[model samples]
Target: MSTHVVVGVDGSVPATEAVEWAAADARRRGLDLRLVHVGPQWLHEGDAGHCARALEEAAGRARAVADGVKVTTEVLSGNVVEELIRESAAADALVLGSRGLGGFAGMMVGSVSLAVAGHAAGPVVVVRTAGAAGAAGASGHGTVVVGHDGSDDSRAAMEYAVEQARARHARLHVVSAWQLPVFSPYAVAYSGLVEDVVREEQAAARERVTPWRQANPDLVITDEQPCAHPVSALMDAAATADLVVVGSRGRGGFASAVLGSVGHGVLHHVTCPVAVVRPRQEDRA
Candidate 1:
């Protein structure tokens, strides 16, 4: 694994928030913090200087917030999303603002942020703006939420979430949302069958985390298996969480697809910082 945390900088308020979040994470993980600003291809002389100042300012803010972390600055000129994805290949995690300067008004998630999160090699964290996040994004709640569905991808996300919760000395909330199969509208007297399915799903969800709970006896872990949509369950959990984590793709996702629908949906709606983690390259095989 890389020994540094990389965050994209664009001198926007949301970017500043992302820098603060990444800096604190770098401090916690004892990794170097790299502040990267990607300039457009048609960069003029004046624009180059402005990019430099933005990097410098971002670096200073990183140092102010995370004193011990080693911070570095880089200004790259290329396609913003492509360059950041390349950076993520060699970093522990890539952090970005929920939206950047190029973002349209009233847009919650920028195209760049979503594109990088979908294609990045490692974990990608999109930090929402304070005003946009509202109360859910406010003071730390000492709780980290993760979505799980007994899939390999979810297991990877769970591992990452466990490490984060342990580092923060916070509780881990494992949420598994399951839906019952739809029966024919004309069918009748299936109450017992519906009840049986619910019980089985609840049990399976609970069983999947039993080992994690037992293994980390000292770490407080809670499991929530709700009969609802995955996004809804996760959003409810993230309402008072410090962070919410989800795998890049889940079980039923297409093998060629990098980001799953649930992961993408949460990124657009979740009020807290969202981490989209993909299984390691080696593990995917």
Candidate 2:
């Protein structure tokens, strides 16, 4: 099957940057690109002819970046996140701007992007404002870092990271962090043992993906063992990565929720783009 990338755009600068980045990626990987613009239901009426026109212009911009890449335009009327999720259900991946033009003081990430990243069925890529233009000029050479903790969700993230690395011809950085019990009565006495246990956990994480790395010799694998919180370590590593891949949820608390603390923390802290991967409900059961 051909790869399909869905990009959410609303005529803002960040959305335009996301469209450009998604277009370049689709062109390089020989994938189809879908540009989606969602507005309030009231705008769908005669009040927002300009919104439809802007979507056409965005479509033209996407087409100019890549020739014959099956570029399609869509304008939906509903909640922004709901419309995006509905449209991107069958897509191979979803690319969205970190922030949009809605709400007061667009300093923080937009709610639409965060909602989709947390709950999308397939891989969701959140593109930030920085390196937006640079990403278009050059194919990404930096590595794709995926956070794995031996969970099914993390394995799904790894699968997406491997595919992205193959497409971009970049290295894959597999990272896992471990922390000792904070409230243990003998914490001081077992400090050394805790350190050793953390190291062993990191080693096991490395072993989990060894077979996949061996199969793809071209993939350079790097493992990290940070003596800090999982969210902080992953965010620090993501600063220099081309893309940060993470599971929707990890092994700790809130395992039943769609997004866990570590995933949510990275979404707000990381500067680079983040891809959250999750398996389908049927696969999980």
Candidate 3:
């Protein structure tokens, strides 16, 4: 079956860019592209016609970029995030503009992108606009980075990242980070404590990637140790990578609810596109 990539659009410039990117990707991979637009019920009643026209225009732009790729568009009336989550479940992958019409300035990503990354059943990519400063990286193909922490969610993310790397024929960079607990000064002050801690964590990370590397010898693996912030380290690496993949939640944060801080932080700060993957609830539990 042809891979189906679903891109969420809200008639914004970023959304248009995402459509173009998705179109090019779909064409290159011999896949199908689905463009989805969701808005409030009032917008649907007041501006549904305009929304339809916008989708047509976006579709035209996508076709112009990569002709012959099967493109489909849909405008749904409901909560934007919920609709996107539902549609994404049926697709092999989901793509969205990093920020949309409604979002706070401090926020690196729009709420819709955050919601999808946090909850989508499959892999979700947040595409940044080209006009943004310091955003462009290695052309269509470059290094793909996946953040792993030995959790099931991170394992799932690694699986998706490996598949994407293979599909794009790009190098894969797997990252895992460890930091001393800030709340415990005693641990930091102890002699050789930090070194010992880092060594153990790095060892664990290497162990985690061992099987994956054995299975795919071609994958380029880079293990890193970012001070105390996983988010900052991931964002720094993502700036140079073609794609950054991370799990929606990790071991340290709120496990039963929304996305953790690192995932949320990367969503906002990374210059390159990011993919957030979540495993099934049973798997997570």
Candidate 4:
């Protein structure tokens, strides 16, 4: 299939970093890189060439970093998030920087990143700052971290994570989190049963991943069953990772509420690029 990676870049430091990351990623995957800049109507009246200038600068920056990759540029006029979502429908992935405004009520976590990741028809990656993802060429670097649970949504996430690890020759860290329900009717009775519940949950997670681990024998894999919240575990893993991967929605909990509050936390709070994977349109049907 025809595919390329689309990175939305504005003329900001974070956006520039995203362009570099996208270009590198595109080169690594042998795909084309498209730099997109969206401007409002007011920009046309005040500074018609603003979008052009931004795209030109971003394309040049990406070309410098990934010299051999095919690069293209685009300028769109309209609602930023809506236009991006539309653009993502035909791309392999939609990438965005970590910087965004808070003028809208629902744009809690870097508006465009969170909204597009939740509702887009494909994977949406929010690129983080360089320091947040650790220093360059350091030891124990560039691990691909993923949050996995025994859910179909999480399976898709793991699939993407494995592909990333294989492509980059990086270790895959699969983390599963467990927590006792605070509002259970037996809350008081099971106050001391948290460990028991966690053990069972960890076993289930391991069982789910066994087949995948056996299939990819050459890839280094680690299964972490942490007795903490999934977000907490994933964020900790992201601290020293090149990429953090997670499902667009999970089984039924904070993770399942990706379109709203939890989405903000996962995408905004993480220190590395976070890939929120969703099912393809054909698979969903």
Q: What RMSD does each model have against the real structure?
A: 3.2, 3.0, 3.9, 3.3
What TM-score, over all chains together, does every model reach? 0.91, 0.87, 0.84, 0.87
Off by over 4 Å in 4: 41-46, 100-110, 131-140, 183-195, 252-257
Which candidate number has the best TM-score? Answer: 1
What lDDT is obtained when candidate 3 is compared to the true structure?
Answer: 0.72
Higher-scoring candidate on TM-score, 3 or 4: 4
Candidate 2 has its poorest 10 consecutive residues by lDDT at 102-111
lDDT of 4 at 244: 87
Candidate 2: tens digits of C-alpha lDDT, residues 9-111 = 7767777778877887788678899887776676634436656776787788788877678888877677777777776678888888777673111423536
In candidate 1, what residue range of length 10 has the lowest lDDT sum?
251-260
Please, what are the lDDT tens digits per residue for candidate 3 over residues 9-114? 7667787777776776677567888887775666634477767877898788878877888889887777777778888777878888876652211223756678
